[model samples]
Target chain A: MFDISFENAKLFKDCVDAIVNLINEGEFEISSEGITLRAMDPSQIAMVDFKMPKKACSSYKVEGDVKIGVNFEDLSRVMGRARPEESLNLKLKDSRLEMTFKGKFTRRFNLPLLDIGGTVPKEPKIEFDANIKLNASVLKDSLKDASLVSSHVVLSIDKNSFVIEATGDRGDVLIETKKEETVVIAHECTNNAKAMFPLEYLNDILKGADSSTVITLYLKTDAPLKVEYPVGQAEIVYYLAPRIENV
Target chain B: MFDISFENAKLFKDCVDAIVNLINEGEFEISSEGITLRAMDPSQIAMVDFKMPKKACSSYKVEGDVKIGVNFEDLSRVMGRARPEESLNLKLKDSRLEMTFKGKFTRRFNLPLLDIGGTVPKEPKIEFDANIKLNASVLKDSLKDASLVSSHVVLSIDKNSFVIEATGDRGDVLIETKKEETVVIAHECTNNAKAMFPLEYLNDILKGADSSTVITLYLKTDAPLKVEYPVGQAEIVYYLAPRIENV
Candidate 1:
């Protein structure tokens, strides 16, 4: 039996919601180190890698390495029905998923297990060129406005400004913030990278990222974008494939 | 030039929201007698009929019948964004729909005429039996629970109790409140007459219905349910088709 417990079930639910919107399902690997999950979309357009350390759990136990198949969408829905103040208790039974939330009335909901006949990919190793920390709410607002204009958004970072731009047949949206804002732009080798990615993919993946939470982004030229947001004691990493601009 | 004004944009928005959700995409006919619309779903499973008398309008000016094809969904979305305290103005300009909301700043949004390419049915003449007054919030809450079990909910009103029961493959949900606590049941017959209707249709038509506001329901055995909810000087009526149940 493998189990990890958290005081707040809502926080875990929030993290699952953001990642599930990007990927359909995942294979969670239980180990002595921690619980780790890494997978990409069917078309390899977007990726999600997550790690929940032992510290996040009040009680952690793992007897052997086990691969548990989980449908995040279903899990998120069940988690969403829980109250914010409820202390979350999760346990895996014979074939059903059970949750006990502590609130006005302790309630339990059961969800049937899904047998998605497929194998998830392992986490990829990529060298990043730039690492930057930015405020979560600012980035969310910029992306929301840009999405109204185009399906794909372009993020171009330079030494002094963090710029987000999107243009389509209908209209165009541009957002730029200076160093004084949450934007801390740095150029090591005068490298200016512009990557275009699907706005919906980014939006879905960032749903779990709280407005007050700071997000650290690892960027590279012509490669997938890596975004990491802390969820309780867990770290959720989302990688999005960039759309090649033919110009 | 045609114009209508409301102090709160959200008030109008809530009313329209209930209407659009009840009826499918269809054209509405505006006449000197006041704005009137009636239509049945494509499958003819449900019918939505609405009318506002000329006296109810702030200003009624219609020399001839004007058929305006306003996409209720699109119109509802624009209206849904309106702030609650803002003064709202709706007007028709040539072939366009215009809405102006005043808050800290006056904002205007345009709605292009839609070519839904459909017809609105003439109002049907049907006699309804058993009309009862109810608290809107109590009805809303009861329906909310019933929807969790099945889309087709059976609503029964007897001399002493009003019951809503929905049983599906998932589970069974029953909400029964007696005249002693929740409602004052009135009837011509003491026997039980149950009719089933789509939950979403009922959910939509409850917009103008407030907690303390009284709602008049006209019902019969296997006949469409009629709900009348008042908004300011206007009263909107919704008739929903019923689903035939085996049990």
Candidate 2:
């Protein structure tokens, strides 16, 4: 028997929200050191990596490594129902999983762990060509406007400016804000790169972000886009598959 | 040519919200003297009757009887997008209904009123038998809890007690709060009566209630029930058909 507690439930909420947006479910391995799992989606389009260390918890008590495949959608739903003021408890009940929130309510659900198909392996450590730090609120606002006009958006970054553009049958929307325009930007990329990506997936990954949260974006030409934001005490890394342009 | 300006959009929102919940999409006759509407849904399961006098507005300006048959639903949707801080302009554009709200930005939408059936017939004045005056907030809470257990609720009143009961396949919920149980027994009815009404219909009528705004309920056994709540400067009366129980 082992127990760990969090001062706030939002940290867990952000992690679940970010992962659920990227993948419906994934393999999670909890060991004596910490919990770690990394995988790319079916199309080899995006990869999601999660790490929740024991030291991050008030109590980091563990005896062995347990690799459990969890359907984050189901777990997120259960966690979503938890009241803000209540403390969350996770435990094993026979073969089912038990979650108790507060001292008042408890829910038990069973999950089947499947052998996640062929191991496509993780991405190679390639240095990102462009790195930019931006406010989540600004990016969120820009995405909202772009999504209104198109299904897929093209993001362009230059040494001095970052641009988001979406054009469709309805209308065209373009949002460009420079580092020196009003906000601070320290972009070093001399050349410009553009890639198209789905808007729905991007919006979902930013669901739990607030105005004050800093969103760091990493990019390379024709490569998966990476968006990283910290939620509560957890760090969430979201990778999105790029849409191929018509030749 | 008709134009009206409201500094705060919420006044219009509150009026539309209360009006929409009580009635189905129907024709509303707008004039310089007052606005009037009366119609029953196609199914005849419910009926909504609305009236707003010229005295309710800041300026009572009119020249002719402008009977524009407005679709309540379309008007509600347009009103839903108005922000409270924005200045709202209601204008007739080329005889087409248009509303422009100016906030951080200007957003204009056009809504065409549909021809709904029926006209507001002269209401036959009737004296209500029993009246109970209570805060809208208190009643809304009671209905919310009772709805959790059943779809049909029974409302009863004794000499000094107010009782609400709802029972379904799941379980039963009962709420009994008396005048003496609190402090105020403004009026009491010695003859006790209970009437059952649909929960969803009741929910609609109570949607725009303000906690501080008092709601007066007029009830009669085997007859329709009427609930009157105050909007900013107008009185909204919601009439609902009651379900009869065979003794």
Docking class of 2: incorrect
For B19-97, candidate 1 gives per-residue lDDT tens digits of 7776546666677776666777556756666666666644456656777777778888898889868888767886897
Residue A191, candidate 2: alpha-carbon lDDT:
55
Evaluating just chain A, the predictions reach TM-scores of 0.88, 0.86
The number of the candidate with the highest TM-score is 2
What is the per-residue lDDT of model 2 for residues B1-247, given as tens digits with 9 covering 90 to 100? 5666667677777888887775656665668767666666455555556677766654444556665666666577657756558777666666556666666445455555555555554443545556688877788889999988898899887777778899988889999888676423254664666689998888877888877778887776656777777787666776777898777
Where model 1 places Cα greater than 4 Å from the true spot, the runs are A61-63, A170-173, A180-190, B1-247
* RMSD per model, one decimal: 10.0, 8.8
Candidate 2 residue pairs in backbone clash: none
lDDT, residue B191, candidate 1? 53
Which lDDT tens digits does candidate 2 get at residues A1-247? 3455655555666677767766766776667766666766555667777778766665555556665567878878877876666666555455445555664565444444445555635755655677678778767766776655477888878776777877764335555666665443346464566678988877877776888788888777777788887766667677887898778
**Each candidate's DockQ:** 0.04, 0.04
